[model samples]
Target: MATLSYNPSKLRNHKPQSHKPISSLSKPIKIPFSSSQFSTLYPSKFSKLRLNSVSESSVSLPTNQPPLTSASENNFNEDEEVDDDPTSEVSYLDSETDPENIIEWELDFCSRPILDIRGKKVWELVVCDGTLSLQFTKKDSIFQVANADNYNKGLQELGIKPVPSKRCLSLLLWLEERYETVYMRHPGFQVGAKPLLALDNPFPMDLPENLIGEKWAFVQLPFSAVQEEVSSLEERFAFGASLDLDLLGIEIDDKTLIPGIAVASSRAKPLAAWMNGLEVCSLEADLAKASLVLSVGISTRYVYATYKKSVATTQEAEAWEEAKKTCGGLHFLAIQENLDSDDCVGFWLLLDLPPPPV
Candidate 1:
């Protein structure tokens, strides 16, 4: 306590301790952080560096690894790849060996005869590989043969041998059958390989008095009569007699047959006009008054006309018999008599009439 009494002079002589301002300080000291602490504090920057490193490593990796094989590829060997080459002859053999790859030989036959835009005959056959197109006229040498034996002989004369393959032979037979059927049935050849007559040519007029009336008469011969040449159409039309008339050419059932001629009477002007406009050879004649329809049936290749009258009197039967007798001589026959009936009596007549000229 006695030694501390003289401190006032020393305190008075000592200046206040100097203090530095905050702005005058140099760079601040940094504290080192642990990995977890750095990541938590600056997650985006850490993540970016980590992504860049991974990308660099991936880009530097080698890319020469083998390609993966598919299930279909695994089914066949590497040698099978060579067989798919189309240019190689081995591919053909490969196709022949594998039933799945084999192309089946086919012939797509046409049911109806084909015609061109100009109505010229055109034959078509679709083979397995492609189409076989052909056109021939009745004047062709191949058509001159009357029967199969003659046809084969003609082919032999032409140095064309029968095809070796049985399948091909069958196809040829089918073709021949089609050709014969077409030759027989086609309208162009229906009149025994003769050219079709012009429409303007007047039909034969000198028929029997019974068959010919003031309004109507039989005109053309039946298709069968023309083909078989049973009697000349000219003679039949000029002089009527009991000639063989057949409806065999019509491709329809006999039981449901109703064949008749539609007469253009003075009252049937509208119908005539319509028929003329249509330019058709045959038409349904239910509306016409002068039409005579007869129920027809095939009796031994001959078409017989039948009539059913309400009153079966002797006179009526005799008249019917006379009408039938008149029709018997000519192929296309129509009676002048009319019946009393309220029902519609006309339907389609599937006669082998020629189509109107183009």
Candidate 2:
């Protein structure tokens, strides 16, 4: 996670305003985690596993750690989403002839449904784009398996920090497609051996007590107002989330009111500093849990607020859903003084996007 600091003295006062209701808005929908008839896909652990391969002899995960499981967290820069056009949800490379022109890639380096010359399982590298329109494949026997230590070391070698972002929807969907059309056709394929992978997010953790602000409130501000304030802030640990709003058929404008949580604390600086280290993604109103879940780093959720502090009603859920669509799924976390203060200590602009498809 990257950090930015700005003087709070330069902030502008925003008057309290009623959030405009979005009429005829679509109802809230959960991220499609289950096949319509096959129940949930991969289990919890498999959702975060990358399909890399290593020699059986080189596998050395700690005794307590799961073998060959590590979320390859990427430090997705804010610029990946077009900064100039807030309405533009995706950014693409300029080359049409370069081949593999998509900015992000989905990969699967794992055992196939076939055997090699030595009667060993065949391994291959499968690549595809989000839409599944493009495909590339390579047959290989060995590659570096991804694990926590290997991921951290790779980032360290590149002189960069790890900031996990969204899950790889392309690879996930590809897995499901293969399971349905390809893998199941093999005579030796066993359902028990190759379990279905799921997109179940990890349980939310408790926030550090000290990081809780003195006061916080659910607020709504105009899109222009929120964007302007974030821009005016001198210091910010920011991430502009990439969204596929076109897929969702959501639209927005300057007057669109975005929903967010505003935290005011005497220890605002320290609070912002602590959050800066976490890859804060989006805030969700979990109706089933009746909790406000803060999604950060790859698949890590935190209990931002419980029902006791902030009730989760259908109306609230619908409001959040509407706001998310209208604003291209952009939600914010504003760390500042009391609700009335004009100055912002730290600001974060975030968006929640659905898992990619292939």
Candidate 3:
């Protein structure tokens, strides 16, 4: 219950004046979250701690000792009444973090020192030798409810089918990750939670886990807000023994796979590993739009039936006859467009990481 600044009085009177940030919002439903919340810069923000001090030194995702609902959770809900859309019936765990009863926790999560002290919700997953922490920032909307049910249906539809863990991770990201802070359980990289903006020197990343904060605290997040949080993230993928050595932004912890229901496709898909030869479907005739990082993530099952692009389509061969003739005209070589078909559309690309060493 400590903080860099404990201004209970300021928090009580604070009311946001500008509506610009909420401009992109369509239908304009008002979701009154706390005044001083954190980042919305990246659709999803993630950082891990790699603890060297724990008894069993290991590479794990952010973790919390089991049963995460904290007891001080209940009274916050009773202190204030939150207004929302009448049509929105999403329910969340009944817990609150009212300013009148706020206890300031340190701003630092990992190596980063955050000033905001808002409530966050998280899901804990157990992986190989570590624990995975999926933290989120919540938002309110009917769109979130639809997104949640869609993700739920996706998991169930693929009941027995084996999907890659990476795909599953992507699906969750595409659903929601509204503006908020995110941290891992075991602190995979070990260093404290450093703000994504604090990268000035080469990462001396090897450090201790400093993400300790209130654990097992329950907060009632409207279902819509919860879904918004899930969608705003960018799922990360890392495999191979050398994943840790790269210093590239990819540190690790996650997975899930999905399949194309309409067509058979093992057709090669673009991958994060393809950084050396990063290719986009169309050239950016407009630099601002094409060059800009459009947010992308894997949702459990996104049914893009109308826009399916299979790289494995042999039908393309018939169309590439002219390029083939030119290669033959040179007498030494034959021409052909890409014979391999792996649609790159489904790939959820992460931009922050340094590409793997050439």
Candidate 4:
């Protein structure tokens, strides 16, 4: 079958803030020699796609780890009016709940398309291609957004693909385990700014009956992957997410649920970049496990090695001695300017790691 071409006139242009324009797939896709192995519409530069076929078979996951699935709750969609103020009896955050055996996290996410325009039915051929798209309404914007669609097939052609919204939480974990890169997606996420899941980031295993959007958690992820919550303007270069449940691929029942860390961040770059410009953060710790300190956050959790005594000093030799002694596992200490909130080149705490056990 002949591949469909993209429409040069309908493409949108975008200014990608911190991401690179993808020219092709990161890796070459192995096309199945057997035609029945896969079903896909070969879309070219033309902005047209049609389903070639539909086959029913259980999708074999790429990895052994499967996506999370939760048993449906009766009230998942039910809405009941409650007292707005927490001082009332309906307050969940105020009620008694176990503080331990819980995980909490707060993270900041940003998402914006380089180019955008709405798409509609063209001669009744318009159909949602099981994926999203960013329609370009102008000539220049199409160049900015997806001019490559004229010849390329799929988002990889335009350097765009729908990132799964739910799996980002899990993917963040995977990135930590796989790549050494510390930062998340490119900076473009900040362009169209809004706060979606600050409160929703924390989980409530042993939580109050009336929990509000306060940043609360037993353990928050230090750094983890997440899908940016956004408005309903779905597009090709659009955002992705994980299906809501235990996004971390953890077991969640009445007794066990894992939560992630999330924080509301300011759109403006300033004294602080994340969590709405709140620079100084406090974290809880386990006094028993003093040697290994864990930082809990919304997306991922991290551990820091600690010594028997507090080690803060201006003397270069003393600082080196302390770091060397503490880091039995590391071969060398790469110490930047000692901890400071304004330190542009070092670790900035979204939630400060709790003091090591005495």
Whose lDDT is greatest here? 2
Total backbone collisions for each predicted model? 0, 9, 55, 68
Candidate 4 lDDT over 70-180, as tens digits, reads: 112112111333222211110011012232322332211221121112221101001111111111111122222243333235545656443322222322332232112
lDDT of 1: 0.24
What TM-score does candidate 2 get on C-alpha atoms? 0.52
**Considering lDDT, which of the candidate structures 2 and 4 is the better prediction for this target?**
2
- Best of the two (2, 4) by TM-score: 2
Measured over all alpha carbons after superposition, the RMSD of each candidate to the real structure, in angstroms, is 48.4, 13.5, 25.1, 26.5
lDDT of 2 at 246: 33
lDDT of 3: 0.21
* lDDT (tens digit, per residue) of candidate 2 on 1-358: 0111222343365632222121111223232211121122332222222333223332222234323211222332323431221111111222222443545555555555544334445454555555433344444334335433554686589675544544444455556555554445533344444331224567889977866776555566665676567665544433232333332234455555666776677777887788776767788877676667888766777888654323334555656656555555667777765655665676777766554321
RMSD of 2: 13.5
Off by over 4 Å in 3: 1-67, 70-75, 78-197, 200-342, 351-358
**TM-score of each predicted structure versus truth:** 0.18, 0.52, 0.18, 0.17
Q: Residues 184-266, candidate 1, lDDT per residue (tens digit)?
A: 44333323222222233332223222222223321122233222222332332321112212211122121111223323123
Rank candidates, TM-score, best first: 2, 3, 1, 4
Error of 2 at 123 (Å): 8.2
| Ten contiguous residues with the weakest lDDT in model 4 | 86-95
